[model samples]
Target: MTIPAPLNGVVPPVCTPLTPDSEVDTASLVALVDHLLEAGVDGLFVLGSTSEVAFLPDAHRRLVVETVTRHVAGQVPVLAGVIDTATLRVVRHAETALAAGADALVATAPFYTRTHPAEIAEHFRLIARRTGAPLFAYDLPVSVHSKLGAELVLELAAEGVLAGLKDSSGDEGGFRSVVLGARSRADVDGFSVLTGSELTVDSALAMGAAGVVPGLGNVDPAGYVRLHRLCVAGEWALARAEQERLCGLFGMVGVGDPARMGRSSSALGAFKAALYLRGVIACPLTAAPQLPLSASEVAAVGKYLAAAGLL
Candidate 1:
């Protein structure tokens, strides 16, 4: 299926369910896909931060893209993350994702090595030139350590070097600047501006964002879908109510003890725990190096689910 130019609506960063040995849980993945499709998500984003892309080996990453793209079968567009530390490596991942049938690719600015702004721009330009596939810049300063400025994003969009942007930088002002800039420029038509902030979907959409790529959408796709609809319908009051409910559920990301695990471990564990309790996946185990949640932490996730009426 062809991806919508300005992709709209709720697009969840699909979680990569893992086996006990940390292999890709294909069966669980397919089930998770069904869960999202049943809830009517506008698109699917796999191998993203929520999916624990950083820890997965190349083979595992390919398996994820293959499993999801094959299972989804084009019912909705599947955007795969081609995140790596540099240009050529990212280009290689992009090729693999494209070969595995991903409809679009999401990548970040080069990381690990400090790159000049010119280098970053050329990084994207090189990937676009090499792959010739629709590319969305993943603006995650927290992880990549390089911020994609609104000016550069607009310049790329205008030049067709980038098709869209997934802003997860948590800078609402910067995000709004990209949104407004994209809309104001006639040459930047069909350039999607998606917010990755689970807490600010309503505000982002209100400010003319194209859609959302919420990680929490994995646990509550229907909630985000409903919130998106309400916002689109101009029902701000109702949207806020729904957003608040989801916001409450978002608290589950903190179930793991900070003293025991890092934020990634806690948040990913919480998501997988929620999925397991919901019976969407067989196991709640995250990838290696990321600590698994304790029974008590899993129980805490259950509490959040119950509070959100999800369980």
Candidate 2:
């Protein structure tokens, strides 16, 4: 499935706002969508890692998708995240996103099972076939150990079972392999690659990627969108400057600790905190457990944002 042009550029897997009671604050969530769009993001990736898809129930996920889609009204693509550990649940959620008028599916492989490539290829092949929509493989091995092997990824693309892969696998070699392999098939149409690592944005673009899917975009949409535009316009030096500035921000927002309390509990919540400081979201709470930043971290992060001119 080809991406609608409006869907490119810095899209954030936007954070979900919650009520004081910690339910899916529907009104705040809707307002958050408006905020992200107003922030000049190209699209919304609801129910993604930043949205804490793992803890979100199917009903809440669908509601989130429906609300974001209705909120956007097709003005921009809404790539709903489907991180089901089970392929059937993946299928279920993928179909739900399509039914909700979403434009694509950002899927991860069987994380719980740590499935092999052949298994992953089959899983995504079936998921893509079932949904009849474009699939962007979310290949980050941080949450789970084995990942979608690049060879199998290209093989799936060759077989027409997938559209693109978001290479958060975090191995520069793997990212290089994905780009080199896909660009080799330039003779074919509709094959693309999106980088998931914010640190690798410049490198990925130079290595022949379609674009990036960095979490940094969650906070600095304008900055990274300018970086992307600069890269597109052949201004690599200027682009790298923005990339580095945004890269500095990622260190804080990308942190995850097994031991933490308060609102900024996880990387996802930290990202929402950045968005909160930037006024992109109405609140900085996740749907479950909730990620709250430490008081000191709040001040520290605020200082950095001011220094970056993001605040």
Candidate 3:
């Protein structure tokens, strides 16, 4: 299926389900996809940060893209994350993902080594030229260690180098600038501006964002879908209420003790735990090196689920 130029609605960055031995759990992954699709998500993003892409090896990443794309079977657009530290490596991943049936690709700036803005632009340009597929810029400065400024993004969009943006930079002002800039430019049509923020879906949609890519959506896809519809229908009051309820549910991400684990562990573990508790996935185990949530932490996640009526 061709992705809409401005892919809209809730597009959840899917969580990778793992077996006890840390291998990809194919069955559970399919079940998780069914859960999101049933809840009305517009698309699926596999091999993203939420999917533990940084930890998975190249083979496993390809498995994820192939599995999700084959399972989805044209139901919705499957966007694979071609994230790497340099241009050539990213191009290789993009090739694998497209060969695995991914409809489009999402990528971030090259990282681990310092890069200049002009070099970053060239990085994207090289990828676009090499892949010849629709590419969306993933502005995740926290992870990539470099920001994709609004001007650079606009220039790329105007030049047809980037098809859209998944803004996870947490800069509301910069995000607003991109949304407004895209609107005012006649040469930038079909440029999607999606927010990756879980807490501000309503605000982002209110400001002309095309959609959302919330990690929390893996736990409650219906909630984000409902929130998106309410906003699209212009029901601000109802949308705000739904967004607030989702905000409360999102508190589950902090259930893991900070002293023992990093935010990635806490957040990703909580998401998987909720999926397990909700019986979507069989196990809540994250990939290796990331600490697992304690039993008490899992219980805390249950409490948040209970409060949100998910359990």
Candidate 4:
């Protein structure tokens, strides 16, 4: 299916639920997909940072895309993240995901190596040439260590080499520049610019972002959907209130003790725990080498859910 020219609305980066043995739990995954779809989300993005795609093996990643795409059954676009360290590796993942029924692909810049902006541009261009599918640039400097510049993104978008961008770099100024540039440039009319910021979604949308790809949406899809609706309806005051409420609910990401685990472990762990508490998924286990939330941390997530009326 053709990805919407300007893919808009709330598209959550769906988490990959795992069994106690660290295998992809198909049932839990199906339930999680249904949970989001029922919440009125516009799309599903799998194998993203929130999905622990960096930690998943190739086989597991394939299973996730295949499972989600087949189960979604075209209800909404399913975008698979081709997150890898470099060009060739990303190409391989892109091929696999497309074969597995993904409608489009999202990719980050090369990691584990110091790369120039030109090389990053070439990397995306190469993937676009090879995949022949809708490709979105995932700007995640925190993970990739390379911030995609607004000028470069605009150049690529105008060239029709990039269908969209998902900015998670946390640089609001740069994001605003891209949002405005994409809007003013006639050559990039169909370029969809999405923000991956849960905390600043309303502002991003107000600045002309096409959509949001919030990781927090995995835990509270309805809340994010409501926030997006309010923004689209131009209910700025109510949208700010809803966004602030979600920001408060987002504090669950801090429940895990940082001394005991890394940020990914804590944030992703909190999300899964919340899902489990909400009965969306069966288990809260993340992939290996990541610490699971303790009992207290799980209880803390429960409290956040209750406070947000999610429980």
Candidate 5:
């Protein structure tokens, strides 16, 4: 399927289920896709931050795209994240994902090395020139350690180098700038501005963002989809109510003890545990080297699930 130029609605950053032995759990992964589909999400995002993309070995990342794209079969767009440290590596993953049937590729700014805005722009330019696939810039400064400036994004969008943006920078003003730029510029038509913030979907949509890429959507996709619809319909009051409820549900991410694990472990563990408790998957195990939630923490996840009426 041709991905919508300005793709809209909820697109969950899918979680990768792992076997205790640390292999990708294909069955659970596919089942998770079904869960999101049934909830009526507009698209599927695999190998993203929520999917443990940074931790996945190259082979497993390929497997994730192949499995999801093949299973989705064009029901909706399948976006594969070509997350890497630089341009050439991202191009390699982008090519592999496209070959595996992905409809578009989402990439982050070149990371780990100190980078300038010119270099970042060149990184994306090179990938766009070489891969020739629809590209979404993932502006996740928290992970990539570099912010994608609105002017730079607009320049690329005007040049046809970027098809869309996934802004997780948590800078509401900056996000609004991109949203406005996309709408105001004739040359930037079909440029999608998506917010990656679950906590601010209502605000983002209110400000003209095309859609959301909520990581928490993996747990309760229907909630996010409902919120999106309310926002799109201009029902601001109702939308805020629903978003607040989901925000409450999002509290589960903090259940793990901080002394024992980093934020990634706590957040991913909470989501996986909720999925397992909801019977969406067989196990809640995360990828190796990440600490698992303790029994108490898992119980905390259960409480959050219960409060959210997901259990």
Candidate 6:
């Protein structure tokens, strides 16, 4: 079967699986992917922020991407996070993924470089031009803090490129702007705008978000699937209540623990922990430098989960 594009159900931003010794464990990695697949996820993401992309070497990144591609076996689309400040590096990664028979690629703007909208547009244009493959723009302003304006995104979409965008901008107005821009224009392909933040999944979906690409969903893929089902069913009352609950869970992840450093440290590590608690993954061991959470925080999570009745 031809791999589906980004717009589907829920695609969990899988945490990078590691060994007890804190190294990339391929066997466990494969197991985790299969586990999530069996749990009802629509797609799998590798080498993303949650996957510890910065820590994994290029060879390791290639290994994870190829492994997912090989094991997924076209059951679902495998999006390798081809993120880098250098456009050439992203292009190279995209080319490699395409060669490995990957279904599609998810890339963001130059993270290290605080580039302008024009520069970001050119960067994606070059990658799209070079690969001639389906591309999704990752607008994660918190990490990169280099916002990719919705208008610029439309400009790329108008060029017969930019099929979708994973908006991690954490701005509802920006999301609305993108949705409005696509709905207003006839030239654009009604580009898919996915939510990268779980806290806003329900809201974004209500605003025409094609799907969600977040790490929190990795904790409870079923919850996201249920939420998506409800949203599609137009059960606004039920969806809103559940969405707020999930948002609360998303908030409970990291409450006063700087071990994971920034979002990467907490989002991925905490998610693996939740999966461990739920009996999905065995170790829940994230990449190194990710000190485990404090006992109090752990207890708080348990209480929060109990309150949410998801523990």
Candidate lDDT scores, in order, read: 0.95, 0.74, 0.96, 0.94, 0.94, 0.78
Q: Give the per-residue lDDT of model 3 (tens digit) for 1-311.
A: 78898888899999999999999999999999999999999999998999999999999999999899999999999999999999999999999999999999999999999899999999999999999999999999999899999999999999999989999999999999999999998889899999999999999999999999999999999999999999999999999999999999999999888898999999999999999999999999999899999999999999999999998
Query: What TM-score number comes out for model 2?
Result: 0.90
Task: Estimate the TM-score of every prediction.
Answer: 0.99, 0.90, 0.99, 0.99, 0.99, 0.91
lDDT of 5: 0.94
When 1 and 2 are scored with TM-score, the better candidate is 1
> Candidate 6: lDDT of 26?
76
lDDT of 1 by residue, 1-311 (tens): 78898898899999999988888999999999999999999999999999999999999999999999999999999999999999999999999999999999999999999999999999999999999999999999998999999999999999999999999999889999999999898889999999999998999999999999999999999999999999999999999999999999999999889998999999999999999999999999998899999999999999999999999
Candidate 4 structure, TM-score to reference:
0.99
Steric clash pairs (candidate 3)? none
Order the numbered candidates by lDDT, best leading. Answer: 3, 1, 4, 5, 6, 2
Q: Give one digit per residue, the lDDT tens place, for model 5 in 234-291.
A: 8999999999999999999999898989999999999999999998988899887789
Clashing pairs in 1: none
lDDT, candidate 4, at 303: 98
The list of candidate 4 runs beyond 4 A from truth reads none
Supply candidate 3's per-residue lDDT for 293.
96
Q: After superposition, how far is residue 246 of candidate 5 from its true place, in Å?
A: 0.3
Give candidate 5 misplaced runs (Cα > 4 Å). Answer: none
Tens digits of lDDT, candidate 2, 1-311: 23662234667777777765666878877877776677677767788776777777777888888888887887777888888786898898888888987888888878777676678778888898888888878887877566777787888878777777777777888878877887676533566677777776877788777777766676776777788888888899998898888877777753445566542365666676676787656677666666566666666667768878877
Error of 1 at 67 (Å): 0.9
Q: What is the lDDT of residue 26 in candidate 5?
A: 95
Per-residue lDDT over 156-208 for candidate 4, one digit per residue giving the tens place of the 0 to 100 score: 99988899999999999999999999999888788999999999999999999
Show the colliding residue pairs in model 4: none
